[model samples]
Every structure is written in structure tokens, then in C-alpha cells.
Target: MSRSPEFVVKSPAMDIVIHSLSDVGPDQRRRLCEGARGIFWDTAEVKDFSSETEREGFIYKYFSYYMEREPELFFCAFSDHQVFGYICGVADTRQHQELYRCADHIPLFDDLYGEYPAHLHINLAAESRGKGLGGRLIEALEGALRTTGEAWGLHLVTSEGARNAGFYRKNGFTHEVCRGILPEEPRMLFMGKKL
Candidate 1:
């Protein structure tokens, strides 16, 4: 794959840089993994963990696992060398299907895999929220995906009433499917947007 462009988002607080995972060092990745703990700290997924280690593992599964397969599609947002958040996915989902299939716990359905081809996941630190940074992350992710090889669009699995659904819709994605495992609510909704 050719090199992807980087972004510099100006803010009164700091200048946030958005780029591929490789651009950042291991320390940054470590800090990211650490700060990532805060992203879902309050979510049921992590809260249900019986131990701290299990909670950490849950974070790693959704955040870092994809980086192992497609670091290029994993975009990181940083400021003063500190990772604030990221938007990463499989530009070529075929490369990571086996890993997803073999997982002990599957977050998504088998047939739903890669329907959007280049699905993404995003998260930001507390200080980084409410600054329109989330949209910027998606814009950068979409921009990079468009420059690469054929990728229909990006898809993300999020449940109804989750704050993220609003951001996804505001960014132009439509609710394509809702797997209702929560009775009247959707266990998960696949949100997609064509590039």
C-alpha cells in the first residue's frame, strides 16, 4: 500500500496529529493502550469482567487486535506525542477473517463480516471529547480509505442509544442492520457509509 497522508488539526488547546499506527512509537502505543482503558471503563463489557486483567483483555480485543492485522488502517490522533484516540479498521477484511472467526467471543455475526469491507472502530480520551475530534477522526479514516485500494466503505457495530450512533449518523452512515438481542433494543447495529 502507498503511504497515507497525515493530518494536523488545530485546536486552542493543542495541535492534534492524525496518522497511521506505524508513525507512533511503542511508548505511544502503550500509552494508547493505557488511556484506552478509560474509553470503555464505564461500559458493561468491561464492567462485567471479574478481574482487572480480564477487563484489560476486553479492551485489547477491540482496540489493539485489528492493529496487529492492519496497522495501516489504524489511525491515531495525537497531541504533544500523547495519543488521544484512534480510528482503525481492516482495509482488507479478508486478511483478518480467520482471526475474527477463531475468536472465543464474537462481537459480530459471521455473515455480517466485511459487508462494509473497511469497517472501523474509534475511541477518545476524556479530555478529547466534545471538541468535534470524533468527526475529525472519521474524516481522516475515510480520507485514507478512499486513497487506498478498492474499499466499498466503512462499517461499525454499535448499539442503539450509544452516543456513538449519533456521531455515525451525523457523519452520513445509515443503520443497515439491527441484531435485536436486547428485546426492544438492538443488541448491535451495523452502521455503514459508502465511500
Candidate 2:
């Protein structure tokens, strides 16, 4: 079996702290979202979401509708005083239902994840992307999922144009389906890993 990496793993000179989103105050949330949006907006071949209102709305809705409901499912990676990476998943059935209701117009979630549990969403600032924080964030989410004893697999949907699919694959997620759920948007790739 592959051995697990030590819990204290860190980049050469960076001090990393991994904690739940609940531990981050509103101001920190704003900072993290702004930093993360800067990175996501510049990603090659992915949709740009740099508009202040759009990014703010995305982060606000995520915290209000999903993370707060399942606090353990959201995690942030911090180095020093700034949040460099973050991951959030919907592990509660009711929250997932609410997401569906709110995202009905966004066909990717409405059609593909309508019946799925534990839908993971992750983002890492460009400067923090190559330090293995992505895998650590996924591991943290898996740990949280295990605590629930649900035995169900974790699932996620990524845009085909986003290179993030490779990162998910490296962390043991497999592409299970593809749905043209959004006619105006790119194809959505649904991936999962049995837990």
C-alpha cells in the first residue's frame, strides 16, 4: 500500500496551516476569495470570473449556503497570514439539495450532481499551486468524509477546459461521466473516488 505523507509536510520555507472554513473570520474570507479569484481568473483555457460581484457572490453563497451547514467540509490552506489555497465540499444531503435548487439555472450542477453527495470544489492561488497543497486539501476533505461514516464515494464536476481535471486525477479521482449539461458552457466532467 502507498504510505501516507506526514501530517507536517510543508514547503521549504513556508509555514502552512490547514484549517476549516469556520475558523476563518469574515474579513479573512474576503481576502482569501480575492486572492483566489486573481489566480482563477488567469487560468488558461478556463472561464474567467474576475468580476468583483461575481467572485464575491460565489464565495458568499458558498459559505452561506454550503460551508456553514457542513463546516467540516470546507478547508483553507494558509501560509503565514494569507490563505493560499482552499477547498469546499457539500457533504450534507440537505445542503446539496439546496445547492441544486439555487443552481438549477446552472445546468452543470442541476443535471450532473442532482443526486450526488460530497461534491468537492477547490482553488489554489497561482503562487501556491505547485507545492502539493491540492492533494493535501483533498486528503483533508476525505478525512472529513470518513468521519461521517457514510461509505459513499466523493464526487466532483470540472469544466473540460480547466486543467484542474489533471490535479483531481492525481489525487485518485476518476472521470466517471461527461454531460453536456450547459449548452453555452463547456462540457462538464464528473469524477469520483470510492471512499
Candidate 3:
């Protein structure tokens, strides 16, 4: 990968380590993914999340399913032995069916912005927001994806009015498409950036 194996970032609170998901044990991996759910998949989105067990399962399925399946393409932000955020990516949108069969259900950009051969999903804990760490996470992911010779760029889908479009644009990603696939879910905006 074009990115370093690991890097230390000094924030006002602590020094955070950004590294591959494989660097941590199973327990920590689960912890990190679960910890970021509040920041990304808020409890308000899950109508039936009345208990911890119910909420955990919904979050895991919606957010960390790919993360649990693909460790190599995932990166974690760790500080003081806690996960502050993470970015999970796939090098090829077409091959998602190979890793997880439900790719058919996901919104497709392959027909439009097909040149961007990679995609990413990012989430950061509340305290970690606006610290410039989110941009760093995107750089780490872009660098890692670039190492794969086949990847020309990356794309990601974010919900409309979540106020995250600017973050992607700030990192050089361009919004290419916006659509709603399911009646219950918010419209999605697909953004892409060339390597």
C-alpha cells in the first residue's frame, strides 16, 4: 500500500494510531466497529432499537457487515486503547458480490461512475469529529486503494442532508448521483474521486 503500515497523529487529547484492521484482535475489532455506530447509524434510524441487544444487531448488520468480512481493506483509528473512528473500503465495486452476496441490494454506481474502482464508508466517534482526523482517514484509505494497481479512484454513498457531502468534496470526491432505493431510507448521494 502507498500508505505507511501505521502512523501516529497528535490531537489535543492524545496521540492516535492509524493502522490496518488486522493489527488488532477479534475483541478490539468488534469493539471499534460497534463504538462508531452512534456517530454514523444513529439509534433514531432503528425504529425498534428499544434494547441494547436489538440495537447492536441492527447496527452490526447495517454498518459493520462488510467490516467483519473484509479486514485488509479496513483501517482503524486508535488512541489510548480506544477506537475513535474507522474507514472500510472495497477495491472493486463489481466484486462486492464475491465477498457478500447481497450486493444486488446496494445502490449501484458501477453503471455511471464506473471508472472509480474503489469505495469507502467512514464513521467517527463524537469526540473525534472536526479534529482533521476524518480527512486523515480518507487519505489513508485513498493511499491504500491506490496501491492496488487496478483501482483508478474511489466512490462512497452518503445520506442526503446528513451534512457529509462537504467532507467528501473537501477530500477531492465529486458527487455523481443521488437517488432513493428504499421507501424507508433516505436518498443517497454517490461521490467519486480519481486517484
How many clashes (backbone atoms < 3 Å, residues ≥3 apart in a chain or on different chains) does model 1 have? 0
- Tell me the whole-model lDDT of each prediction, alpha carbons only: 0.70, 0.64, 0.71
Clashes of each: 0, 0, 0
Q: Which stretches of candidate 1 lie over 4 Å from their true place?
A: 25-45, 51-53, 102-115, 181-186
Expressed as tens digits, the lDDT of each residue in 60-161 for candidate 3 is 544566567667778878875577887877778777664334443254455744777688888788778898899988888776776656588788877777
User: How should the candidates be ordered by TM-score, best one leading?
Assistant: 1, 3, 2
For 19-88, candidate 2 gives per-residue lDDT tens digits of 7655567777666555555544554233458797766566554444545565556677776567777777
TM-score for every candidate vs. truth?
0.79, 0.73, 0.78
Q: How displaced is residue 110 in candidate 3, in Å?
A: 3.0
Those runs of model 2 whose alpha carbons end farther than 4 Å from true positions after fitting are: 1-7, 23-57, 60-64, 93-95, 104-116, 182-184
Residue 54 alpha-carbon offset, candidate 3, angstroms = 8.6
Q: Report the backbone clash tally of model 2.
A: 0
How well does candidate 2 score on lDDT at residue 139? 86
Clashes of 3: 0
Alpha-carbon RMSD of each model: 3.2, 5.4, 3.6
